[model samples]
Structure formats: C-alpha cells, structure tokens
Target: MAEEKQKKKGGCLKWGAIIIGVLILFGACAAAMTGGGEDTGDTSSDSNEAETTETATEESTEEETEEATEEVVEEESPDAGIGEQLDVGAMSYTVNEVTTASQVGPSAFPTTANETYVVIDLTVTNNGNEAVTVDSTYFKMIIDGATFDADSAASMSANQNENGEITNSFFLENLNPGSTMSGKIVFDVSQANADNPEKALQVQEGIFGTNSGTINLQ
Candidate 1:
C-alpha cells in the first residue's frame, strides 16, 4: 500500500508539471502574436502618413504652377493707346496724329513709297534732369507684330522746309528738360500692314532700342 501511494503521488506531480509547461508555451505564443500584430499596425500607420505627405506635396506644386501662369498672363497685357503719353525711363512720347499716304512732301519733290507710307507725328518730351539725344532710328512701327524701321531717306524728303531744305529735327538732336521735340516718322510698309488693327509704334529713349514703350492703334 505504501508503494502504490508513492507511485500515485509521483504520477500526479509529473502530470501537473507537463500541464504547466503547456500553459507556459501557450502564453509565449500569444505574446509573440501580439507583438507581431503591433509591428504590423505600426507599419500600416507609417505607410498612410507617407501617402498623405506625398498627396499634399503634389497639391502644393499644382497651386504654385497655377499662380505662376497667372502672373505670366498679366505681364503680357495690352499696351497704351494713341494720344496717350507713354513714359519710359527719362522721356515721354505722345502720338498726335497718324496718317497713311502713297507719297509725302511737295509734288515737285515727292518721296514716294514702295507700297505705302505710314506717317506718325509724335512729340517727345525730355523729363530727365539733364539732356537726352533723339534719333530717327529710335522709332519703330509694329504692324501685325512685325517691326519696321523708319524710312530715313523718305523722312529727309518729307521734313523739307518751305525753301526745300532739311529741318534736321529728327536726327541726332539734343533736347533739355521741360523741352519737347515734335517730328514726323515715316515707315514704308505695305498697305495691309498700315491698315492692320494690331498696330503700334514703339519709341525708345536711346538708339539701342532699350527702355521703350508702345502706343497702340485701332
């Protein structure tokens, strides 16, 4: 009877140890699964945040592009009209009259055009503190977006005096402040160009054509 009791006690103790070992293994597996689930959730959250940042960056870039395009459009707006003074760096230009003619000057000493002549009578006022030089080359007629130089030979003939001599006003003439110089600038352009709606005359403060502004035509 004593031996049987000892065997029974040893059997119960061994079974209890095995059951405890099984419970410990189950706890370890559950802990590992919980840790792995936490890591996966963290990775998913990081991926969502990265996606949101990328989307915001794309939207910001698009908005900046739109603003840049708007600024460019505003910069290309139309210029001023005729009879209005366009002020540049140190001078101001005003178109008094615009006429188209097949020829200029007196009939005996006429300066005929190849197609037609666009005569622009304008006034340039010196607004600077010092003096500035004016020349015929500083003016250009823009017709249908095409630029045409002033007809120098025709201009000399057109600006002849009552005695049939040159006036030399549109040449290399020096002007002081509060002084105005008026002359006719002739462009030997085609009739189509003279009658174009998108016409403008560009006047520059120097011979290099820098610091210029335009006067639009009808």
Candidate 2:
C-alpha cells in the first residue's frame, strides 16, 4: 500500500508540470499577437498622414498655376485706337489726322527721287498739375516692322505760306496744365512704304518713356 501511494503522488507532480508549461506557451503566443497588432495600427496611421499632406500640396500648386496664367492674359491684351484718348500717366494724346504725300519740302524746294512723306496731325493736352515737355523724337512711324523718326527740318519747310514763309515745327515744347497744342509730325520713307504704311503708330512722352501702346492709324 505505501509503495502504491508514492507512485500516485509522483504521477500528480508530472501532470502538474505539463499543464504549467502549456499555460506559459499560450501566454507567449498571446503577447506576440498583441504586439503585432499594435505595429500594424501605427503603420496605417503614418500612411494616412502622408496621403493628406500630398493632397494639400497638389491643391496649392494648382492655385499658383492658375494665378500665373491670369497674369499673362492681362499682359497680352490688345491696345487702343487713333483719335482716342491715350493716357500714359499724367499726359494724354490723340492722332487727329493722318496723310500721305508724294513729297513734302519747302514751297519751291527740290524733292528726293524715291522718298515720300507721311504727316500726322497730333493733339496733346497736359493733364498734370505741372508742365510737361513733348518732343518729336518721342514719336515713331512703324512701317512693316521698321521704325522711322520724324524729320523736323523737312516738315517745317513743307506747307509754307504764300510768301515762302515757314510754320513753327512741332518739337521740344512745354505744355502747362489744362493746355492743348495741335501740330504735325513728318516722316520720310520709301514711296512703297508710304503707300502701304503700318496700321499703328507709337507715341511716347520721353526718351525710353512709358509706352502709350500702339494707336490705330488706319
């Protein structure tokens, strides 16, 4: 009987050790599963943040592109016409009339063989509080993309008085506030170009001054 009882106690000890080992293994597996689940959740959060940032960056870039395109369109708008008020800053000008002549020299002056003249009747008004100077050098005639300056001497010699008298040339004059002056500018060009001049003329207020844009001459 004593030997049987001892054997039974040994069996109980062995079974108890086996059950404890199984419980420990199960706990380890559960810990590993929980850690893996936490890692997956962190990765998902990082991915969502990255996606949101990329979307915001794309939207900002699109807005900037649209604004730049609008600016370019405004800059490329077409200019105004002749006999229309063109204000560069403080002064204004208008081309009242345009004429082409076979030749324009002193009443009895000789003419060039292949040269002709284009005259522009201009009116300038000083809109500023102070005086401003208007010079013929600031004017140019564009013919087939070519630019020509006014010929003041030849212009003064043309359209003379009956006694061979000459009119005052329109150049280098000061205009006071609310004052208006009307005069003519003459340009010598080839006969072919004079007959078919460019459709626009350029008027400026100073050397390298602000452009009043191309005025329609047709």
Candidate 3:
C-alpha cells in the first residue's frame, strides 16, 4: 500500500508539471500576439493622422490661390458704368446724340485701313465768366484701349451745307459765360471698333486738356 501511494504522488507531480509548462507556453504566445497588435495599431494611427494633415494643407493652399487670382482680375479690369454728367474746368458738357456713319454726305473721306466715321452730338455750356474755345483737340475716342484724335476734315465734310450759328461740325468756337453751343464731333476709327461699339469710349478734356472725364459708350 505504501508503494502504491508513493507511485500515485509521483504521477500527480508529473501531471502538475505538464500543466504548468502548457500554461507558460500559452502566456508567451498571448504576449507576442498582444505586442504585435499594439505595434500595428500605432502604425495605422500615425498613417491616418499624416493623411489628414496633408489633405488639410492642400485645401488651404488651393483656397489661397483662388482668392489671389480673384484679386488680380479685379485690379486689372477697367472701370465700367461711366457716361453721366461731367464737369471739367469751367465747362459743363453733355453728349446728347451719338451716331456712326459709313459715308459722310455724297462722298467718303479717304482714311487709313478699316476706317469709319463716328459722329457725336454734344452740347457745351461755359460756366466760367470768360469765353472758352471749344476745339477738336478737346475730344478723343478710346477703342479697344487705343486712343484716336478727332477728325476735323471729316466733320466739316459731313455738315457742309447745314445751317445754324453753330454749324453741324466741331468747329473751333468761343463761348461766353452762360452761353451753350451744340454741335457734332467726328472721329475716324477702324471698322473692327465700329462694329463693336461695346468697346468704344469717349474722353473729353477741358480747357488746355485739364479736368478730363471719360464716357463709356458700350
């Protein structure tokens, strides 16, 4: 009986040792798996954060670029919606009628390349106490950003037999204070510009080219 008891105790010890070994191996595998999971999770979190930061930076840059472009466009564009009342020096001027003609009277004056006549009927009142000379030099036309001087010969030819103290031409005239003179001023321009009156501009300068103001015909 003593021998059997001893044998049984020995068997118990062996089984205990086997169970302890199995437990140790299981714990080691679990630790390795947990460590690997932690590493993978950290790497994935870092990658996501980097992607988010990069996307935000790109969006901000694009917004800034768009805003800058808009500002540049605004600055480069010309002013629109002119052509109202204008006071230059001591003279107040008004452009009442504007017309375009392919031919002046029965004959067409000789012009350089693609030229056409533009007639503008204007009324000028001298507000100053002294007389002021209103001449062709006071008027200019801007087309497609290019300026053209008034054509005196063409204007004279257009209003050849027209009667009135103030002839139908942009004749050099002296106006006394409170007196108003109304006449037409003619200009020679390219047909390309005449075709697109939306791009035409009229500029008037007061005595000695002072107090200039612009009117947009378009």
Candidate 4:
C-alpha cells in the first residue's frame, strides 16, 4: 500500500507541469499576433495621410498658377484712354478755302487787252492737335483741264490774288493744330480763252499726282 501511494503522487506532478507549459506557449503566441496587427494598422494610416497631403499640395500649386496668370494679363493690357487717342491721330485732315479774285495791273487798260489779272485768295486752317507749317509753292491750280503751277501764277498779296478761279494743287509742309495760314494766287485769263468756269478752278490735296483732293469753285 505505501508504494502505490508514492506512484500516484508522481503522476499528478507530471500532469501539472505539462499543463503549465501549454498555457505559457499559448499566451506568447496571442501577444505576438496582436502586436503584428497593430503594426499593419499604423502603416495603412500613414500611407493614407501621405496621399492626402500630396493632393492638397497639387491643388494649391494649381490655384497659385492661375492667379499669377490673371495678374500678368491685367498689367499688360493697354489703357482705354490711350487707345482712343491713338485712333484719333490716324484720321486727321486740314480745312482750306478759296477766296474771291481781285483786279491787278492798270485798271484803265483797253477792254480787248489782257491787262487785268485774276487773283485767288486761300485760307488754310489746321484742325489737328499737332503744329503744322505749309508751303505755298506746293499749291497749284487746275483750270479747264490745264494744270497751272504755283510759280507761273501771278500774286498781288500773300493771301489775295487777281485770278478769277483757282484750287489747291499740292499739300506740302506740316500744318500745326489750331493754326491758320493764308496765301494768294494770280492768273491771266482772257475772256475768250478762259476754260469752262466750273472746271477751271480745281485743287489737288496730296503730294502724289492723281491722288490729290479736289475743291470745287465757290
């Protein structure tokens, strides 16, 4: 009976040791699994945060670029007032008038003799804002399909002439704005040899031939 009791106590001790070892191993495994799960969750959260940051940065950059482009366009645009002034400069013209004729030379000459010369009076006004100076020599008269140079025309005064009819032949020199200049032209026209009254006094406006402006008899 003593030997059997001793054997039964030894068996109980072995069983207790095996149970303690199994419990210890199971606890270690559970802890390791939990730690691995936490690491995976942390890595996923970090990746999401990084992606969000990159998207925000790209959006900010695009907005900044758009704003900068708009600013540059505004700065480079021309002022409305300046643009209007430039338009006015391109369409400017001068005003001119032909004056009446006066008698020259001896007034008592024989009726048949061509002693009386006709004069033309011209007044030119500059309507532009710029200063202008015009030369009388550039002017000519077209009478009855015939062109009369300024040099050949007789003159009694700077702005008065003995010619019965005349027109502008040339436009020379710069005419300043808001200024007036006067000149006279003279011609010797016999009543019989005179050209058509209407066509005799034509004036040209520009420097180029056939491209000049014409003024009808007043």
Evaluation by TM-score, superior candidate among 2 and 3:
2
**1-218, model 4: which lDDT tens digit per residue?**
89999899989999999999999999999999999999999999999999999999999999999999999975542222111211112222222333333343333431122443445555556566566445545445556667755433245222222352323422344656675555555555544333345433333333332323444443
Task: Name the runs in model 4 displaced over 4 angstroms.
Answer: 1-3, 79-218
**Listing every candidate in turn, what is its Cα RMSD in Å to the true structure after a full C-alpha superposition?**
3.6, 4.1, 8.5, 17.6
Would you estimate the TM-scores of all the predictions? 0.77, 0.70, 0.53, 0.35
- lDDT by candidate, in order shown: 0.84, 0.75, 0.70, 0.49
Model 4 misses residue 183 by how many Å? 23
- Among all windows of 10 consecutive residues in model 1, the one with the lowest summed lDDT is 73-82
Task: Name the candidate, 2 or 4, with the larger TM-score value.
Answer: 2
Once fitted onto the true fold, the runs of candidate 2 whose alpha carbons sit more than 4 angstroms away are: 1-48, 66-78, 110-114, 143-146, 158-168, 195-198
* Candidates 1 and 3 compared by lDDT, better number: 1
List model 1 lDDT by residue over 93-210, tens digit each.
Answer: 8888889999987678798999999888888899999988888888888876678999987776777765787765587878888899788888998888988888898887776765
List candidate 1 segments past 4 Å from native: 1-63, 66-78
Native RMSD of candidate 2 (Å): 4.1
The clash numbers for all candidates, in the given order, read 0, 0, 0, 16
The deviation in Å at residue 158 for candidate 2 is 5.0
Model 1: lDDT equals 0.84
